[model samples]
Target: MQNSFVKVPLWLFERVVGFLLALPIPIYSSAVYGLVTNMRGLPHMLGMYIRGLYYRQKLGLMEPNVFIDQGVFFAYPQGVELKEFSYIDKNVLVMSKTAKVGRRVHIAPRVFISGGGDFEIENYACIATNSNIITSTEVLKDGARCSGPMVSADQRRVFRGKVLIKKDAFIGANATLLPGVTIETGAVVGAGVTAAKSTEPWGVYVGERAQRVGTRDSVLCPDN
Candidate 1:
């Protein structure tokens, strides 16, 4: 019998590319900072342009109007797809071997969406600032440790499961969405809530354990 599994060196390549692309920032800043003062917009545009260029040059593809801010780290750009009108805010870190995002999704600042498995977010979904969506099993540091309020042995499976936020779902600020969880269409997840299980469609969820507080006809849209 022959071995059936084929091992691809994707992790090594990701690290190497990340390192090479990040190397020029320090050098460029050191050389140009002295000559340019009050140049705020230029640096941001240049960083965005460089990030876009690196994504295209290294990965061979990137959709238009996908804004990547400075210091945003991605494990595999090829596995990530941002549709039209999608905005990834500053300092956001996304790591997914396979992740698909739909159009007009607003990912706020300091958000972390990571998983080894695939995670999908439908169009018009609003993810508030500092929200965390943990998708794969590797993301959990300890599978056996379960001491916290939200901790359980089953929580370890979150990293392995696929997370789906349906269209028009609103994830409020500082919320933690665990694995295998699906936010149904028009659902509203309140701020600072940790959802360990799936939520019903068109309902308002709150609290640490994320219980259903109320029912609404439609999902609560984020403030513009």
Candidate 2:
């Protein structure tokens, strides 16, 4: 039961938003996207709902009942896939060519997901606010690097890998998951941790370079 203040059908509105979302990425990724969705009250609600519906149609995959919040900054979203009951919070920047987001996933506000390769997030995963999942890094040749769109070919480098998060994983706020790392099922990353490797299943990890501390099942099933 979607409550709408406006007369337009949700589907119709979705289609309209889809059209806007399909505009050339590099140009309208920020401005038009923000302009349409940054309003308050009914307009904001409408914007959020319409954006979700629009992405569902335009993206590689998107399931039902997904709430995409206002001001979600998605770059190259054509290859991103989202599953059922997933919620992407406001102002989260997902810059991925092929990112697979799974069922019941909740991405908190201002998370940065940058994937040049395939980044896969499994079911029941929560990415907390200000976390970063980076699947690629710049490869500098001869100590040369490119800052903007204009740079010599020799200064350009794009190294890519996959980031895998198993089911029931929680990425803490401001955590950084580096390229080619996997967070196993039921693993908990403490806030401000920077994980550079795969976590043990159900393990609690914390610190700048995260290490396993305890098993999640101990707390989850205390009597067991």
Task: Pick the lDDT winner.
Answer: 2
TM-scores for candidates 1 onward, in order: 0.67, 0.78
Residue 18, model 1: lDDT of 48
What's model 2's overall lDDT? 0.78
Q: Tens digit of lDDT per residue, candidate 2, span 60-136?
A: 78887777777776677678788888888878888867878888899998998885767788888899999999888
Pick out the ten consecutive residues of candidate 2 with the lowest summed lDDT.
215-224
Off by over 4 Å in 1: 1-44, 59-61, 138-159, 219-224
lDDT of each: 0.71, 0.78
Sequence-dependent TM-score of model 2:
0.78
lDDT of 1 by residue, 1-224 (tens): 13333224544454565455544477764443222221222236766554554554434245666666655656776777777767777667877666777888878889998756667888889899999998864343655543432676465434378889998899999999887899998899999999989999888999988999898687456633
User: For this target, which candidate reaches the highest TM-score against the unseen true structure?
Assistant: 2
